[model samples]
Target chain A: MVKAAQRMYYGKALAKLAERKEIVVLDADLGGSTRTSDFAKVAPERFIQIGIAEQNMIGVASGLAAAGKTVFASTFAVFATGRCWEQIRQAVAYPKLNVKIVATHCGISVGGDGASHQALEDIAIMRALPNMIVISPADANEAYAATMAIADLKGPCYMRMGRADFPLITSEGVKFEIGKAAVLRNGNDVTLIGTGQMVMSCIEAAGILEQNGISAEVINVSTIKPLDSETILASVSKTKCVVTAEEHSIIGGLGSAVAECLSENRPTPQIRVGVKDSFGESGDPGELMKKYGLTTDDVIKAAENVIGKKGKK
Target chain B: MGGAKGLDVKDLRRRADKIRMHVIEMTSEAGSGHPGGSLSSADLFAVLYFHVLRHDPKDPEWEGRDKFVLSKGHVAPVLYAALAESGYFPVDELLTLRKIGSRLQGHPVKGKPPGVEMSTGSLGQGLSMSCGLALAAKLDKKDTRVYCLLGDGELQSGQNWEAMMLASHYDLNNLTIFIDRNHLQIMGSTEKTMSIDPLAYKLRAFGLRVISIDGHDIKKIIKACEKARSSSSPTAIILNTVKGKGVSFMENNADFHGRSCKPDEKEKALKELTERMSSW
Candidate 1:
């Protein structure tokens, strides 16, 4: 499996956007870790090192956006979303400013730094805000494309990326849109929905399910806020049962979004594969994924469980 | 810079008195608001709008206009009054404050009424925004200065300190922060609420040129803002003001910090301001 860190691709995308003078990047002393140093290397003048103050970083981004500059505020997911959630709500979302809060090192994959460093609830909180566009890119390629896409977009957006280098699932030139989901592989026996690094696990699970004569469809749900209900409904209408996967918690992230969409339109049987409303512990990234039930085998097990309930009363 | 846009100190005082009267009337009409802070900062707002700020109320989005952010946004009355008086909108619309479907929300919302620059109600956030606007102006090579007004009590939020460090780090010479040192918060005096005193020393330690002055003095306000504009780095102007200035019953009173005057109290406050206006 060819793996690439989404944060790396995000930095590359920012460096590529150096020619756009209106673009400004801000980081809160985590530039090297979050990879915004890539942008600073090229467009040193436009990149703002806002020290370790996430709340003030968001405020500065809001002011820059108000002054007609496209601002991308980058930091760890915990600080970017958790420490300054209200600042984002008041300064960015309320005004509907053109500030993209791209957070890196999301989910339990941020190992060794422990629970305090991991951000398992960012998706839920970011999704709750009005006028906020929440996205979780499936891979590094999609992260790069989404970075370019959001710069072209003019409003408040939150894009969450992972810490470890996950499998490259999407193609290099994947056309990323703000509110649309991309269907990766096609089948009929069951539907597999996933986001972030977990989407790769979903695709791998579909392959395993195919060997057992149970066909599975893979859908990468990157844009979590506007749940691309049309695409999701169309797949579930044929598949009848569903399994959702993500590196975040099962509460208000991708799992909850899919559940709400299905309950409203399709009423299909679904199993959500994510952290079970618990905090993460310090461990290897792969070990954390397995312990938290976010691995490919977990997706396969969820698929089997939901598929069993497909034909039942 | 010397006396304020050809308007003498007497004229500016009259303008401030009218703004204070509008604050009293608007808050009484809304039946709620932070009139104490609004009244305290009315003089600063008057000086900024009438004297120092380079703005066109007729063309609120004028490219060359300077930006002012009401960091302590609960004081919407003074900003609304100043904008209305400066012709951003009709003065009659000032009465619609805090009412449903009015652009004049309880707090200053950006683009709600063209003159309001940033949407600020949450404290300790506006200074960082002012830094952004100032940095952008420098990046864009515009001479536009950014000013922010904050409540002294709001300094406890910690985010303000973060912003102060950024301002000094970036050498945001185009930015000026006015700390409304009315010495009062909702609970009690700021000294008792949480000591942020030795305040000027703290600001200087944070790498700002701290200027302390009587906030109600129109000439001093104008001169301090002017000095801040030309500063080699960020400046903090400490405006020593009464909590509820001008109104004898409300001055230095914490109860009026977030309350509206009663009907008779409103009448008395209005009468006092009117008399002060007539004397000018």
Candidate 2:
């Protein structure tokens, strides 16, 4: 029922986007799950139903952008980024086209549909591109704001959203900027930087850490690329220990980006909690997240481990 | 409008001949370049730059200017010659065609080089990009048209069909596609390798206003372009052309697809081009 509510929220967001005449919605045949059906009904003329062709959808969006239309191209994160990577690189990122890619069903949360549906490498692939802003919003509200913000932005961006329902963490009317990080909770002992679905997990973990007398600074890093370097650097400088959580690969996702930033700007003890260089399997979203060490407990454990290492140093 | 017909067809022909000559020289200088496709599309480029397209050579980024995307990008020599002759850059810059630091890369680079709307070499993509540009112009209510040139061999890519379906579905009357149907590719003849036959019919079936003409004949090429501009639907003009139209030895030769002419061969090619120019 909560999942149904989340879908309703996405549908409402799509409806709001459709009301804006410049907003054009494109679907790679996954309009139902993506909740783009609402927008399609409201503005069929603005909606382009590109059937199962991810690469062409990206190119078409890039074309639409050239025509002065703000386009939102949606599909499963796996197919949208992986299948049409070259087109994104050439037509969108290389040309710096103003096209917002709304990639749904990201991470191991895309349950039952299994590893094939889950997108663990979407962040890695999108972040590697030159002029692409990668955003993995935490909840339906963040997704809504991210969609609207990216539309107004002048360059290409990839918005990663989850399939399963995520709890609404941030309150309504909260200002969301493209490159700024949201500091959810403040602490001095250890910094917990998280993105996407993991932001809610980190927030919960920060509460648990508080009970144990560890002041854990929880930062919701929505924008992965053009990262909030100022916030990350300041937090790491004060905390001296950092834990990055994400529903993505440990190799090149938010964790790697944070590690790279810390290693360069400030040398801090860091532990990355994510899907360990492995594929997800068929299971419930919660069970799969826990099994793959992507739960709130994992973030807590990672924070403790990094803090221990920081104390030794 | 009748005065456009009087706008120096002879001078346009001479420019096309010079572009063909430049393609031979540049390809020979680089020791590697596509001369065949370049020669075939020379007249099309001449018409686009000289008379047809509303492009300002001085301000390449003039937003009101019509867009031209060379999908078959290996034929950069022809584009370089035309851009240089049209005063986008100095004529001497043509010699730096494929040099390391040259803005004129082996393929066109958009925004960096004047007159090039999209940077393309990976085939089957230009048509899609052009479709976007045309679709964008339509959305903006701009009267500017988007033109894309594709090689017959490049048609082997599936992306072209995807773009074709979209172009037709949108009824992008502002977009005009020219296929340099020279029938020769790097390996061999297009038919011997992969038949793109009934090409005109296939385009028509995809809901395009299809036209067939001699790609090298300036008169027919110009006429087809004018007809494409007048059509209510997107146009796909198939230019039945020789791989290398000007050079006798290189004509219909697949080896000229990416091979450079030898020093002695360059002299012979230049001499032939000069004689043809004098006669004209």
- Best-matching candidate per lDDT: 1
Clashing pairs for model 2 are A63-B132, A67-B136
Which residue pairs collide, candidate 1? none
TM-score of each: 0.98, 0.92
Model 1 quality (TM-score): 0.98
Residues A1-313, model 2: lDDT tens digits: 1332244455678788787888888887899988889898998877887777777787778777866678888888999899989888888888787788878888898889999988999999999999999998877777777777876798899888888778888766556799999889999999999998798889999999999999999999999998999999988788999999999999899999998898888888899999999989899988999899999999999988888998575
What residue runs in model 1 are displaced by over 4 Å at the alpha carbon?
A311-313, B1-4
The local lDDT score (0 to 100) that residue A78 gets in candidate 2 is 92
The segments of candidate 2 whose C-alpha lies over 4 angstroms from its true place after superposition are: A1-14, A17-21, A311-313, B1-8, B29-31, B59-64
User: Candidate 2 lDDT (Cα, whole model)?
Assistant: 0.85
